[model samples]
Target chain A: MTMFTRSDKVSETGGGAKPPARDDTPAPAEAKRPQATAQPLSHTAPPPPPKAAASTVSVISKALKITGQLESTEDIQIDGMVDGDVRGVSVTVGGDAKIKGTVYGEEVKLSGTVDGKIEAQRVVLTSTAHMSGDVVHQNIKIEAGAFINGHCRPDFGKPESKALPPPHKPAAAPPEQKRDAVVGAP
Target chain B: MSALSLSSLVKPPRRDDAEELPVSHLGRALTVRGVLDTEGEIRVHGKVLGRINADCLVLDTGGLVEGDIVARDVRVSGRLNGRIFALHVTLDSSADITGRVFHHTLTMAKGARVEGRMPWRPLNYFETLEQLPETRQ
Candidate 1:
């Protein structure tokens, strides 16, 4: 998925796995500065394309610890300890992870401990999840063994819209309004 | 030059461990504000504003890191505004660093712009650097 990655996420893009037409271009095997090699080739000089190798996913390794806010447009996989708020598109709290502040995301999958609130469109609390605050989600899948000490709210968008008629409308507006709500609330 | 460096003292070396562990890459669009500690290599293409402790750190061009870095091997190609404590350090041509660099061995490309003191330490100094020096406010 090319959700929120940049054009040159991986250095290997300078070498192999290029398109058939790009093979003739002279690319450095390990291009330290990819833009320098990429700029001269295309005469039109179109913006560099973001390939599959250019992963924008940020991984918080198990040994890491953060004490400040983390905001990202791309996916974030946290396996360490965080003492502040996290905002991302897909925020995954790994099994040993511990987040001590609010988490805002489109999809939040938790398998560890969260001492603060969670606001997301879709929330999945795995068996290892230990939540200590309120959870706001539109669609929830809580495993049987999950531990939660917060109020689960199904309202993430227009609160009155949940009671509105037209069940087929659930397909289109929930996501659009949820994004707006998240932006407005913050 | 190699005799007094930590690279000669450490048997396996930091780059050797990088091949064995899982490397984490942060693309240019990401921004982080916190502490990152890992045994593996970390390639930063984004912006980081906090402390980073890794075996090897490679800051790519256009990347920016603001804070302290404690690693065995540090390679900077972008901009950095913090202290660095590493056994071996390499500043590329595009590097723009403004802080202290405590290293046992160093290599600077022709065009690297460094605005700080590079204090050379012994291998034992790096081995015993469990905590970074307190920064002046």
Candidate 2:
């Protein structure tokens, strides 16, 4: 009797009810109505401008200088100087780029100079690339004219226990670990 | 306007005026924490948690900025929780600002929601401003 009346009210109000599973949970359903009404009151007010800025490919142009950290869920193309760490999905360091901190990404391509470390799944050092720190990558490509003064290790995403040993060698050694993986077939 | 005032507002003294500075874009999914000093234009579609010094700054519709902004021209269509010191300021319809805007010229759209004061300073005020005034309010 009273149950039928309450359900009819719920349906007629907005028809937004979840089909009650057992018909025995009338108290909880009634409680949801107050919250639903509260929503409209706030919705009528100025809406919060869409939250944080959109995440698209961020481009740091040649004239810009960032002195702090930069984090992105998308790609980043840097043509400027960054003093702090940069974490992105795909980081592309352009010809005149200079990064003083660590760079973490899925794909890191360098054509400029990086003073810190690079940890990525795939790393590409172009002809003009000048890297002075260590690079930890799963698959890496170093062009003929690229200048790398640091250790290049193929240990990205590997468990820490097995990642022991720096494999430090002479500057002439050409990232044998990753070359071995290529021959072993990644 | 006096010749002194016109020169101050018409053009800001920037390094390498003959060079065409490229535009930098910070996409929506990016979050930058630190000082970004640039000579060119910067479009922020992402969140910036630190101070920004740029020639021109555009905060797109979905962006949220939380620090002081020092720029020549500032256009906001997003949310800003910090102060702005600029020669020219334009607030779009979707702008939701909480801090003060110190500018020489300000144009605010009808639907913009501003909570703090919009103080208008002379053109020379921006040119001579070496540092932003400390936040007292």
Candidate 3:
């Protein structure tokens, strides 16, 4: 009998036996509530001025003499003297580099002198390089005339670009005609 | 307090039993309280008032950090007002840093503003020659 009365009251209030409507207002859905996500929030403020975009930046290391650490996120060329640590994504030590500190990078190309450690994904020592430190790289390449006095353990399985000859250029003139012209002109 | 007995009362745990546990949020956020040594990338989107040490650090656009940062690769596209020590560093066009920056490779975009010293400058014939004309006059 009480259950029947409760059902009568529920039917009198609303169609379902859930809850009586208050002020006849529709409640918000629970799933439609705000929730936080992993994405960062965006502000509705005015946008700032546009800035320049630098896809590639190069450092030509020449006669620069550095006493402290040197680092970068792009390609680097070391043709100077560095007293402290050096690091980059891609590092190229010219024949004139006289680095006395450790080197860290993704890929390192050496043609200079280093007295400290060389750690990278891959390392390449050219004929002119005179290294006197330990090397820690997944891949290593030593040229024929390269001089290295460092410990080497080549893993040979790393994602790094190797040294290759510059791209060849096509002949501007016909080979036979150029040869004939050279033979006649001289 | 009464006299304590060594054998009757339980002693503190031994050093061997205590593990060398790291803080869960060590390398996350702009935590300036402890060392932020990481083997992965760290992005700073807020302010840091103290020292920061990491493997690689990337400051996204609109990020503002103020402290000392030490890392292997440090790239900034925001504002920094502190010292930076890294193996390499890149200041994008949106960067506005004011402090000393020490690195092996240092690059700044066209619109980037930096007030610090560059430790090394490799040979750039064009840049060198460009300065020659001004110095000669």
**Top TM-score model:** 2
Give the worst 10-residue stretch by lDDT in candidate 3 chain B: B1-10
Report the C-alpha lDDT of model 1 over A29-100, residue by residue, as the tens digit.
224334432433211111122232556788876655667888889899988778899999999999989999
RMSD of each: 16.8, 16.0, 25.5
Docking class of 3: incorrect
lDDT of 2 by residue, B16-128 (tens): 65147777889988999998888667888889999888767888898889998877768899899999988768787799999999986666666899999999887666766
Best by DockQ: 2
Q: List model 1 lDDT by residue over B12-62, tens digit each.
A: 444444455555667777788877766666778889999887767888788
TM-score ranking, high to low: 2, 1, 3
Docking class of 1: incorrect
* lDDT per residue as tens, model 3, A84-184: 78767788888987888888888999999999989888899999999998888888899999888868855334433342222322343467788999999
lDDT of each: 0.75, 0.80, 0.57
Clash-forming residue pairs, model 2: A53-B28, A54-B28, A54-B29, A55-B28, A55-B29, A56-B28
Q: Which lDDT value does model 3 have at A1?
A: 100
lDDT of 3 by residue, B18-110 (tens): 222111111112222223333333455543455554444676566566776755557788788887765457677689889877654565666
Listed in order, each prediction's TM-score against the native is 0.66, 0.71, 0.35
